[model samples]
Target: MENRPQPFHITLVRHGESVGNAEARWQGQADYPLTDTGRAQARALAERWKNENAKFDLLISSPLIRTKETSEIIAATLNVTVEFDPLWLERDNGDFSGLTAHEVRQNFTHPQFSTPYDPVGGDGEGDWELFLRAGQALQSLLKREPARYLIVSHGGLLNQFMHAVIGVAPQANNSGTRFRFGNTAFAQLMYYPHQHRWAIDRINDHAHWKDTD
Candidate 1:
Protein backbone atom coordinates (compact mmCIF):
# COMPACT_ATOMS: atom_id res chain seq x y z
CA MET A 1 0.00 0.00 0.00
CA GLU A 2 1.17 3.51 -0.79
CA ASN A 3 0.75 6.47 1.44
CA ARG A 4 -1.61 9.15 0.11
CA PRO A 5 -1.28 12.80 0.84
CA GLN A 6 -3.92 14.44 2.93
CA PRO A 7 -6.62 16.17 0.92
CA PHE A 8 -6.76 19.92 0.90
CA HIS A 9 -9.51 21.14 3.21
CA ILE A 10 -11.13 24.49 2.55
CA THR A 11 -13.83 26.39 4.40
CA LEU A 12 -15.34 29.37 2.65
CA VAL A 13 -17.11 31.82 4.94
CA ARG A 14 -19.00 35.02 4.16
CA HIS A 15 -18.72 38.00 6.41
CA GLY A 16 -21.49 38.80 8.84
CA GLU A 17 -24.28 41.30 8.14
CA SER A 18 -23.08 44.72 7.11
CA VAL A 19 -24.77 48.09 6.96
CA GLY A 20 -24.88 47.70 3.22
CA ASN A 21 -26.65 44.37 3.52
CA ALA A 22 -29.09 45.74 6.02
CA GLU A 23 -29.77 48.74 3.83
CA ALA A 24 -30.00 46.81 0.59
CA ARG A 25 -27.04 48.63 -0.89
CA TRP A 26 -24.58 47.50 -3.54
CA GLN A 27 -21.54 46.69 -1.45
CA GLY A 28 -19.29 45.65 -4.33
CA GLN A 29 -15.86 46.30 -2.85
CA ALA A 30 -17.14 49.30 -0.96
CA ASP A 31 -15.80 49.24 2.56
CA TYR A 32 -18.31 48.91 5.34
CA PRO A 33 -17.94 47.89 8.96
CA LEU A 34 -19.91 45.16 10.59
CA THR A 35 -22.99 46.06 12.53
CA ASP A 36 -23.48 45.01 16.13
CA THR A 37 -25.64 42.19 14.92
CA GLY A 38 -22.87 41.21 12.57
CA ARG A 39 -20.43 41.02 15.46
CA ALA A 40 -22.83 38.83 17.35
CA GLN A 41 -23.19 36.57 14.37
CA ALA A 42 -19.43 36.23 14.12
CA ARG A 43 -19.25 35.41 17.80
CA ALA A 44 -21.87 32.73 17.36
CA LEU A 45 -19.99 31.20 14.46
CA ALA A 46 -16.76 31.30 16.43
CA GLU A 47 -18.40 29.49 19.30
CA ARG A 48 -19.78 26.87 17.00
CA TRP A 49 -16.38 26.18 15.41
CA LYS A 50 -14.75 26.17 18.84
CA ASN A 51 -17.20 23.59 20.10
CA GLU A 52 -16.61 21.46 17.04
CA ASN A 53 -12.83 21.80 17.50
CA ALA A 54 -12.41 22.90 13.90
CA LYS A 55 -8.77 23.49 13.01
CA PHE A 56 -7.16 25.15 10.04
CA ASP A 57 -3.54 25.65 9.03
CA LEU A 58 -4.25 29.00 7.39
CA LEU A 59 -6.97 31.65 7.65
CA ILE A 60 -7.24 34.27 4.93
CA SER A 61 -9.70 37.13 4.61
CA SER A 62 -10.59 40.13 2.50
CA PRO A 63 -9.23 43.31 4.02
CA LEU A 64 -12.58 45.10 3.82
CA ILE A 65 -13.84 46.16 7.22
CA ARG A 66 -16.78 43.74 7.26
CA THR A 67 -14.69 40.69 6.40
CA LYS A 68 -11.80 41.85 8.54
CA GLU A 69 -14.02 42.02 11.60
CA THR A 70 -15.60 38.68 10.92
CA SER A 71 -12.21 37.02 10.42
CA GLU A 72 -10.81 38.65 13.51
CA ILE A 73 -13.59 37.34 15.67
CA ILE A 74 -13.21 33.81 14.46
CA ALA A 75 -9.42 33.90 14.45
CA ALA A 76 -9.35 35.17 18.01
CA THR A 77 -11.61 32.37 19.11
CA LEU A 78 -9.63 29.79 17.19
CA ASN A 79 -6.25 31.13 18.30
CA VAL A 80 -5.15 31.59 14.70
CA THR A 81 -3.72 34.60 12.96
CA VAL A 82 -5.37 35.95 9.84
CA GLU A 83 -3.80 36.96 6.55
CA PHE A 84 -5.61 39.53 4.42
CA ASP A 85 -5.78 39.18 0.67
CA PRO A 86 -7.28 41.55 -1.87
CA LEU A 87 -8.08 38.64 -4.14
CA TRP A 88 -10.81 37.69 -1.71
CA LEU A 89 -12.40 41.10 -1.86
CA GLU A 90 -15.95 41.46 -3.07
CA ARG A 91 -16.77 42.04 -6.73
CA ASP A 92 -15.97 45.56 -7.79
CA ASN A 93 -19.18 47.31 -8.88
CA GLY A 94 -17.63 50.50 -10.27
CA ASP A 95 -20.10 53.37 -10.23
CA PHE A 96 -22.61 51.21 -8.43
CA SER A 97 -20.44 50.80 -5.40
CA GLY A 98 -22.12 51.94 -2.18
CA LEU A 99 -25.35 52.82 -3.97
CA THR A 100 -28.72 51.67 -2.73
CA ALA A 101 -30.98 49.58 -4.88
CA HIS A 102 -33.44 52.41 -5.44
CA GLU A 103 -30.62 54.77 -6.28
CA VAL A 104 -29.27 52.38 -8.88
CA ARG A 105 -32.59 52.29 -10.69
CA GLN A 106 -32.69 56.06 -10.75
CA ASN A 107 -29.03 56.61 -11.65
CA PHE A 108 -28.23 53.86 -14.10
CA THR A 109 -29.97 52.25 -17.01
CA HIS A 110 -30.15 48.48 -17.21
CA PRO A 111 -29.64 46.81 -20.54
CA GLN A 112 -32.25 44.24 -21.46
CA PHE A 113 -29.58 42.18 -23.11
CA SER A 114 -26.07 41.85 -21.78
CA THR A 115 -23.23 39.35 -22.08
CA PRO A 116 -21.15 37.76 -19.36
CA TYR A 117 -18.24 39.89 -20.42
CA ASP A 118 -20.19 43.13 -20.00
CA PRO A 119 -18.67 45.35 -17.36
CA VAL A 120 -20.79 45.87 -14.27
CA GLY A 121 -21.82 49.41 -13.30
CA GLY A 122 -20.19 50.70 -16.44
CA ASP A 123 -16.63 49.92 -15.31
CA GLY A 124 -16.38 47.10 -12.79
CA GLU A 125 -15.46 43.52 -13.51
CA GLY A 126 -18.08 41.53 -15.39
CA ASP A 127 -19.14 37.99 -14.65
CA TRP A 128 -16.30 36.53 -16.70
CA GLU A 129 -13.74 38.84 -15.18
CA LEU A 130 -14.83 37.94 -11.68
CA PHE A 131 -14.79 34.27 -12.53
CA LEU A 132 -11.24 34.61 -13.78
CA ARG A 133 -10.20 36.42 -10.61
CA ALA A 134 -11.74 33.66 -8.55
CA GLY A 135 -9.74 31.15 -10.53
CA GLN A 136 -6.57 33.07 -9.86
CA ALA A 137 -7.28 33.07 -6.17
CA LEU A 138 -7.86 29.32 -6.18
CA GLN A 139 -4.69 28.77 -8.13
CA SER A 140 -2.71 30.75 -5.60
CA LEU A 141 -4.05 28.60 -2.81
CA LEU A 142 -3.31 25.36 -4.66
CA LYS A 143 0.26 26.50 -5.25
CA ARG A 144 0.87 26.21 -1.54
CA GLU A 145 1.36 22.93 0.32
CA PRO A 146 -1.85 21.09 1.01
CA ALA A 147 -3.36 22.16 4.31
CA ARG A 148 -6.61 23.22 5.89
CA TYR A 149 -7.59 26.71 4.73
CA LEU A 150 -10.27 29.05 6.03
CA ILE A 151 -11.33 32.02 3.92
CA VAL A 152 -13.50 34.90 5.09
CA SER A 153 -14.88 36.93 2.23
CA HIS A 154 -17.96 38.43 0.62
CA GLY A 155 -20.87 36.58 -0.94
CA GLY A 156 -20.25 37.67 -4.52
CA LEU A 157 -16.61 36.60 -4.63
CA LEU A 158 -17.37 33.44 -2.72
CA ASN A 159 -20.05 32.59 -5.25
CA GLN A 160 -17.53 32.87 -8.06
CA PHE A 161 -15.03 30.84 -6.08
CA MET A 162 -17.53 28.03 -5.78
CA HIS A 163 -18.23 28.26 -9.46
CA ALA A 164 -14.53 27.86 -10.09
CA VAL A 165 -14.42 24.82 -7.82
CA ILE A 166 -17.30 23.15 -9.63
CA GLY A 167 -16.27 24.32 -13.10
CA VAL A 168 -19.42 26.32 -13.68
CA ALA A 169 -19.28 28.74 -16.56
CA PRO A 170 -20.52 32.27 -16.11
CA GLN A 171 -23.84 32.94 -17.76
CA ALA A 172 -24.80 36.02 -19.67
CA ASN A 173 -27.02 38.77 -18.32
CA ASN A 174 -26.81 37.57 -14.71
CA SER A 175 -28.58 34.35 -15.56
CA GLY A 176 -25.98 32.18 -13.86
CA THR A 177 -26.55 30.16 -10.73
CA ARG A 178 -26.02 31.97 -7.46
CA PHE A 179 -24.85 30.46 -4.21
CA ARG A 180 -26.59 31.70 -1.11
CA PHE A 181 -24.23 32.83 1.64
CA GLY A 182 -26.11 34.57 4.39
CA ASN A 183 -24.39 36.40 7.18
CA THR A 184 -21.76 34.23 8.82
CA ALA A 185 -22.71 31.27 6.66
CA PHE A 186 -20.00 29.01 5.33
CA ALA A 187 -19.33 26.16 2.94
CA GLN A 188 -16.87 23.33 3.46
CA LEU A 189 -15.01 21.69 0.59
CA MET A 190 -12.26 19.16 0.06
CA TYR A 191 -9.83 18.72 -2.77
CA TYR A 192 -7.68 15.68 -3.55
CA PRO A 193 -5.07 17.29 -5.75
CA HIS A 194 -3.30 14.00 -6.35
CA GLN A 195 -6.58 12.62 -7.72
CA HIS A 196 -7.61 15.91 -9.28
CA ARG A 197 -10.92 15.77 -7.51
CA TRP A 198 -13.03 18.15 -5.46
CA ALA A 199 -15.90 17.54 -3.11
CA ILE A 200 -18.41 19.97 -1.69
CA ASP A 201 -19.10 18.79 1.80
CA ARG A 202 -21.60 21.51 2.68
CA ILE A 203 -22.95 24.83 1.52
CA ASN A 204 -24.61 27.66 3.42
CA ASP A 205 -24.08 25.88 6.71
CA HIS A 206 -25.17 28.14 9.54
CA ALA A 207 -26.32 25.66 12.12
CA HIS A 208 -24.93 27.80 14.85
CA TRP A 209 -27.69 30.35 14.40
CA LYS A 210 -30.42 28.08 13.19
CA ASP A 211 -32.30 28.45 16.42
CA THR A 212 -32.34 32.21 16.10
CA ASP A 213 -33.77 32.27 12.59
Candidate 2:
Protein backbone atom coordinates (compact mmCIF):
# COMPACT_ATOMS: atom_id res chain seq x y z
CA MET A 1 0.00 0.00 0.00
CA GLU A 2 1.12 3.56 -0.66
CA ASN A 3 2.40 5.51 2.32
CA ARG A 4 -0.44 7.96 2.53
CA PRO A 5 -1.65 9.85 5.54
CA GLN A 6 -4.45 8.21 7.43
CA PRO A 7 -7.54 10.36 7.44
CA PHE A 8 -9.04 11.60 10.66
CA HIS A 9 -12.77 11.15 10.34
CA ILE A 10 -15.17 13.31 12.29
CA THR A 11 -18.89 12.88 12.46
CA LEU A 12 -20.50 16.02 13.85
CA VAL A 13 -23.91 15.71 15.40
CA ARG A 14 -26.05 18.55 16.71
CA HIS A 15 -27.97 17.76 19.84
CA GLY A 16 -31.62 17.03 19.57
CA GLU A 17 -34.34 19.54 20.42
CA SER A 18 -34.30 20.98 23.91
CA VAL A 19 -37.07 22.58 25.94
CA GLY A 20 -35.74 25.86 24.61
CA ASN A 21 -36.05 24.66 21.06
CA ALA A 22 -39.59 23.47 21.56
CA GLU A 23 -40.45 26.67 23.36
CA ALA A 24 -38.49 28.92 20.99
CA ARG A 25 -36.48 30.39 23.82
CA TRP A 26 -32.92 31.70 23.83
CA GLN A 27 -30.82 28.80 25.14
CA GLY A 28 -27.47 30.61 24.97
CA GLN A 29 -25.06 28.72 27.25
CA ALA A 30 -27.78 27.73 29.66
CA ASP A 31 -28.28 24.05 30.36
CA TYR A 32 -31.60 22.81 29.10
CA PRO A 33 -32.31 19.12 29.22
CA LEU A 34 -33.84 17.41 26.25
CA THR A 35 -37.57 17.54 25.86
CA ASP A 36 -39.59 14.34 25.45
CA THR A 37 -39.43 14.78 21.69
CA GLY A 38 -35.76 15.56 21.96
CA ARG A 39 -35.11 12.30 23.84
CA ALA A 40 -37.02 10.41 21.17
CA GLN A 41 -34.90 12.14 18.54
CA ALA A 42 -31.72 11.04 20.27
CA ARG A 43 -32.95 7.47 20.44
CA ALA A 44 -33.68 7.52 16.75
CA LEU A 45 -30.25 8.98 16.01
CA ALA A 46 -28.66 6.24 18.10
CA GLU A 47 -30.56 3.60 16.18
CA ARG A 48 -29.60 5.16 12.89
CA TRP A 49 -25.91 5.19 13.70
CA LYS A 50 -26.09 1.65 15.04
CA ASN A 51 -27.73 0.44 11.87
CA GLU A 52 -24.99 2.09 9.84
CA ASN A 53 -22.32 0.42 12.01
CA ALA A 54 -20.66 3.77 12.70
CA LYS A 55 -17.82 3.31 15.16
CA PHE A 56 -15.76 5.96 16.86
CA ASP A 57 -12.54 5.97 18.84
CA LEU A 58 -13.62 8.96 20.84
CA LEU A 59 -16.92 10.62 21.54
CA ILE A 60 -17.02 14.25 22.59
CA SER A 61 -19.95 16.35 23.72
CA SER A 62 -20.70 19.80 24.96
CA PRO A 63 -21.03 20.25 28.72
CA LEU A 64 -24.52 21.60 28.24
CA ILE A 65 -27.20 19.20 29.40
CA ARG A 66 -28.97 18.89 26.03
CA THR A 67 -25.82 17.81 24.28
CA LYS A 68 -24.81 15.72 27.28
CA GLU A 69 -28.04 13.79 27.11
CA THR A 70 -27.75 13.32 23.36
CA SER A 71 -24.16 12.17 23.64
CA GLU A 72 -24.96 9.78 26.44
CA ILE A 73 -27.64 8.05 24.41
CA ILE A 74 -25.55 7.81 21.26
CA ALA A 75 -22.41 6.80 23.14
CA ALA A 76 -24.33 4.08 24.94
CA THR A 77 -25.36 2.66 21.60
CA LEU A 78 -21.86 3.01 20.16
CA ASN A 79 -20.26 1.69 23.35
CA VAL A 80 -17.83 4.57 23.55
CA THR A 81 -17.02 6.76 26.52
CA VAL A 82 -17.87 10.44 26.15
CA GLU A 83 -15.48 13.28 26.92
CA PHE A 84 -17.06 16.59 27.82
CA ASP A 85 -15.57 19.63 26.10
CA PRO A 86 -16.89 23.05 26.93
CA LEU A 87 -15.39 24.40 23.75
CA TRP A 88 -18.09 22.53 21.89
CA LEU A 89 -20.79 24.24 23.91
CA GLU A 90 -23.24 26.65 22.34
CA ARG A 91 -22.65 30.37 21.95
CA ASP A 92 -22.99 32.46 25.06
CA ASN A 93 -26.10 34.64 24.95
CA GLY A 94 -24.93 36.97 27.69
CA ASP A 95 -27.94 39.01 28.71
CA PHE A 96 -30.29 37.15 26.42
CA SER A 97 -30.07 33.75 28.00
CA GLY A 98 -33.33 32.01 28.84
CA LEU A 99 -35.45 34.64 27.18
CA THR A 100 -37.97 34.42 24.36
CA ALA A 101 -37.43 36.29 21.10
CA HIS A 102 -40.04 38.84 22.08
CA GLU A 103 -38.40 39.24 25.43
CA VAL A 104 -35.01 39.75 23.84
CA ARG A 105 -36.48 42.34 21.51
CA GLN A 106 -37.98 44.13 24.47
CA ASN A 107 -34.68 44.20 26.30
CA PHE A 108 -32.00 44.71 23.66
CA THR A 109 -31.76 48.00 21.79
CA HIS A 110 -30.49 46.60 18.50
CA PRO A 111 -32.26 44.12 16.24
CA GLN A 112 -29.06 42.11 15.69
CA PHE A 113 -28.47 41.36 19.36
CA SER A 114 -30.21 38.00 19.25
CA THR A 115 -28.80 37.03 15.90
CA PRO A 116 -25.29 36.58 14.48
CA TYR A 117 -25.11 40.11 13.12
CA ASP A 118 -24.11 41.63 16.44
CA PRO A 119 -20.44 42.59 16.80
CA VAL A 120 -17.97 40.64 18.92
CA GLY A 121 -17.94 43.38 21.54
CA GLY A 122 -21.64 42.87 22.24
CA ASP A 123 -22.73 41.96 25.74
CA GLY A 124 -23.52 38.41 24.69
CA GLU A 125 -21.15 36.22 22.75
CA GLY A 126 -20.33 37.66 19.34
CA ASP A 127 -19.11 35.75 16.33
CA TRP A 128 -15.48 36.12 17.24
CA GLU A 129 -15.77 34.46 20.66
CA LEU A 130 -17.83 31.59 19.26
CA PHE A 131 -15.41 31.14 16.39
CA LEU A 132 -12.52 31.08 18.84
CA ARG A 133 -14.19 28.33 20.80
CA ALA A 134 -14.59 26.30 17.64
CA GLY A 135 -10.97 26.94 16.86
CA GLN A 136 -9.94 25.59 20.25
CA ALA A 137 -12.06 22.50 19.73
CA LEU A 138 -10.55 21.92 16.30
CA GLN A 139 -7.03 22.32 17.66
CA SER A 140 -7.78 19.79 20.37
CA LEU A 141 -9.19 17.36 17.82
CA LEU A 142 -6.09 17.70 15.66
CA LYS A 143 -4.01 16.25 18.49
CA ARG A 144 -5.76 12.93 17.91
CA GLU A 145 -5.09 11.66 14.42
CA PRO A 146 -6.06 8.63 12.34
CA ALA A 147 -9.12 8.01 14.49
CA ARG A 148 -12.84 8.45 14.27
CA TYR A 149 -14.51 11.10 16.41
CA LEU A 150 -18.22 11.49 17.01
CA ILE A 151 -19.11 14.87 18.43
CA VAL A 152 -22.44 15.72 20.01
CA SER A 153 -22.81 19.51 20.07
CA HIS A 154 -25.01 22.51 19.44
CA GLY A 155 -26.08 24.23 16.20
CA GLY A 156 -24.14 27.48 16.44
CA LEU A 157 -20.98 25.66 17.41
CA LEU A 158 -21.39 23.30 14.51
CA ASN A 159 -21.73 26.24 12.15
CA GLN A 160 -18.70 27.94 13.64
CA PHE A 161 -16.67 24.76 13.43
CA MET A 162 -17.55 24.27 9.81
CA HIS A 163 -16.50 27.82 9.04
CA ALA A 164 -13.29 27.34 10.95
CA VAL A 165 -12.47 24.06 9.21
CA ILE A 166 -13.13 25.59 5.82
CA GLY A 167 -10.94 28.58 6.72
CA VAL A 168 -13.56 31.25 6.12
CA ALA A 169 -14.52 34.36 7.97
CA PRO A 170 -17.22 33.81 10.57
CA GLN A 171 -19.20 36.77 9.31
CA ALA A 172 -22.22 35.31 7.55
CA ASN A 173 -22.82 38.46 5.58
CA ASN A 174 -19.25 38.64 4.36
CA SER A 175 -18.34 34.97 3.97
CA GLY A 176 -21.82 33.88 2.92
CA THR A 177 -21.53 30.57 4.81
CA ARG A 178 -24.55 30.63 7.00
CA PHE A 179 -25.38 27.01 7.69
CA ARG A 180 -28.50 25.75 9.34
CA PHE A 181 -28.31 22.56 11.39
CA GLY A 182 -31.65 21.30 12.46
CA ASN A 183 -32.07 19.30 15.62
CA THR A 184 -30.22 15.96 15.46
CA ALA A 185 -28.67 16.89 12.12
CA PHE A 186 -25.08 15.94 11.40
CA ALA A 187 -22.07 16.60 9.18
CA GLN A 188 -19.25 14.32 8.12
CA LEU A 189 -15.70 15.64 7.81
CA MET A 190 -12.30 14.14 7.16
CA TYR A 191 -8.94 15.64 8.00
CA TYR A 192 -5.85 14.97 5.95
CA PRO A 193 -2.96 15.16 8.35
CA HIS A 194 -0.41 15.37 5.59
CA GLN A 195 -2.08 18.33 3.90
CA HIS A 196 -3.34 19.89 7.10
CA ARG A 197 -6.75 20.26 5.52
CA TRP A 198 -10.30 19.20 6.22
CA ALA A 199 -12.78 17.78 3.69
CA ILE A 200 -16.49 17.94 4.35
CA ASP A 201 -18.36 15.05 2.81
CA ARG A 202 -21.64 16.18 4.27
CA ILE A 203 -23.03 19.37 5.78
CA ASN A 204 -25.97 19.70 8.10
CA ASP A 205 -27.70 16.57 6.92
CA HIS A 206 -30.95 15.60 8.58
CA ALA A 207 -32.16 13.23 5.88
CA HIS A 208 -32.52 10.40 8.36
CA TRP A 209 -35.42 12.23 9.93
CA LYS A 210 -37.04 13.32 6.68
CA ASP A 211 -39.51 10.50 6.47
CA THR A 212 -39.88 10.15 10.21
CA ASP A 213 -40.62 13.81 10.61
Q: What is the TM-score of each candidate against the true structure?
A: 0.97, 0.90
Q: Each candidate's lDDT (Cα)?
A: 0.92, 0.83
Give lDDT: candidate 2, residue 120: 28
**Candidate number achieving the greatest TM-score relative to the actual structure:** 1
Candidate 2 residue-wise lDDT, 77-100, digit = tens: 889989998888888888788888
- Candidate 1 lDDT over 3-32, as tens digits, reads 898899999999998988888999999988
Local distance difference test, candidate 2? 0.83
Best-matching candidate per lDDT: 1
Residue 184 in candidate 2 has what lDDT? 90
Candidate 2 collision pairs: none
* Per-model tally of clashing residue pairs: 0, 0
Model 2: CA > 4 A from native: 111-122, 172-175, 211-213
For residue 84, give model 1's deviation from the true position in Å. 0.6
